[model samples]
Target: MCLLAMSNSLLQSAKKVILTEAQAVMMLADGLDQSFIDACQLIQNCTGKVVLIGMGKSGHIAGKIAATFASTGTPAFAVHPGEAGHGDLGMITQEDVVIAISYSGESDEIMTLIPIIKRLGILIIGMTKNVNSSIGRISNVHLDVSVEKEACPHNLAPTSSTTVALVMGDTLAISLLINKGFSVDDFARSHPSGTLGRRLLTLVSTIMKIGDDIPIVSADTKLLDALLIMSQKTLGMVLITNNNNILKGIFTDGDLRRVLETYPNIQSLTISKVMTPNCQSISKDRPAMAAVQMMDEFNLNSLPVVDDNNQVVGAINTHTLMQAKII
Candidate 1:
């Protein structure tokens, strides 16, 4: 009974936190200002890199924002304000744009670097809640990210304010991305190690079974022989090719089942007699995601991959696509 009561209390607390965060997000959405546009314009017009600076939790969010900008076509990097006072300030050039993040706009670490940054002639964009604070007053462009209260019960932690800052940063990055005509292919190039890259950049040639691994049989081959080859390849299907090695049709598991039901004596039938004549085929250079879509639209589990001359080059199955995370 004690454990059950504890669990109930924890669940209730979690729900309250979620509701508070939702309310805070709504407040941010309602308080959009022109200062946001000014900040974006400054960054967009910057001739050099974007330098993001912040302290504590704001610093972590600023780092993520800098990474997003760099990956999405805008060249940017995060520099700790405290380190800027040492020697890291050299990373900033006169043509660069600096973005400083602080909830109260009076973080001592960030304040100490402002004069040096200004003396360097670098453009300054301030992201803060207080418009009259030191950083805001000195900045060329000020973006307001004020929040009514934090999601934290004591209102001491940077919860809602950090969320607002992150959203604002994402908005700026995406706006610049669109303005620069960043494409899906460009994103794929930036993320080559993840599932997104595999889905967008992986070609049929990379995943399809080629040469000896492909289950192929001549049109005159018996259905039983084709089934044996299909079983050996473990692809659940076999392709029917002409004497010129060109794809003519496909004999899949479904076709075998239908043939068995329609003609119980199909064991002795020729493969060409029962195969699907108008089977879907894809090019070797087609994107893996496109192949998955074609299979889904045609209600097929496998497809024959062909070359420019319509010759059967390879075959791919749903399992292969699943392993590659293309579906």
Candidate 2:
């Protein structure tokens, strides 16, 4: 009975904390106004990077906000207010915009660098509870991230306030992302090691099988010979081309099944008689993701990679895409 009561009490406390933080986020959303717009425009117009600064708990949130901004097409980085006072202040330039995060609006370390930042004529965007606070009063634009109360029972820890500030930072970064018309391809270029990067940046030429690796048979080849080549290639399909390597058609396992059922004497038939003529092919220069889409839309297991003159240069299949993780 004692343990049960303690568990219930802990659950109630956890529930209260989540509800309080959620309400704080809703309040932040409802309070959005022109200050948000002004700050976004200021950062967008900046020719140099965005410099984020804060102290203590706000400093941690500032680093996360900086990372979010940098990944989402905005050039941004965080500078510890304490470190900035030492020498990191030199990183900021006249063309850069500084976003200062301090829930109380008066961090001594952050305040110390305000004079130097102002001297360089760099714009300052302040996020705080009150517009009239020290940091707010000196800021070119002030974003109010005030919350009704912290989720902490004593209202001492930086719980709700920090959540609100991080949300505000995300809102700003995403708004800039859309306003600048940043694309998935552009985002992929910045993150080459991520999954999206591999899908978008990987060209079909890099993944497609070339030369003997591609299962190819001349149009005059018998259906039995084509099946042998497909079995050896293990790509589930074979490409049919002319003597000059000009693509003519494609023969897949599915086509083989249908041909077996339709023709009683399949051994005597040429590959051209049962193969899919004028098959949908892709250029090797296209992104591998495009090949995935094309194969999915056409219900194709493999595709012939053609050159400018419709000559077979390579071949790609669902298996290759899966190997490359482009699927």
Query: Which candidate should be chosen as best, given lDDT against the real structure?
Result: 2
Worst 10 residues of 1 by lDDT: 20-29
lDDT of each: 0.89, 0.93
Best by TM-score: 1
Regions more than 4 Å wrong, model 1: 194-199, 322-327
Cα distance off (Å), candidate 1, residue 25: 2.0
Clashing pairs in 2: none
Distance from true location, Cα of 102 in model 2, Å? 1.1
Per-residue accuracy of model 1 over 238-321 as CA lDDT, tens digit each: 999998889999999988889988996876799999999968999999888889889989999999999888899999999888
What's the true lDDT of residue 273 in model 2? 90
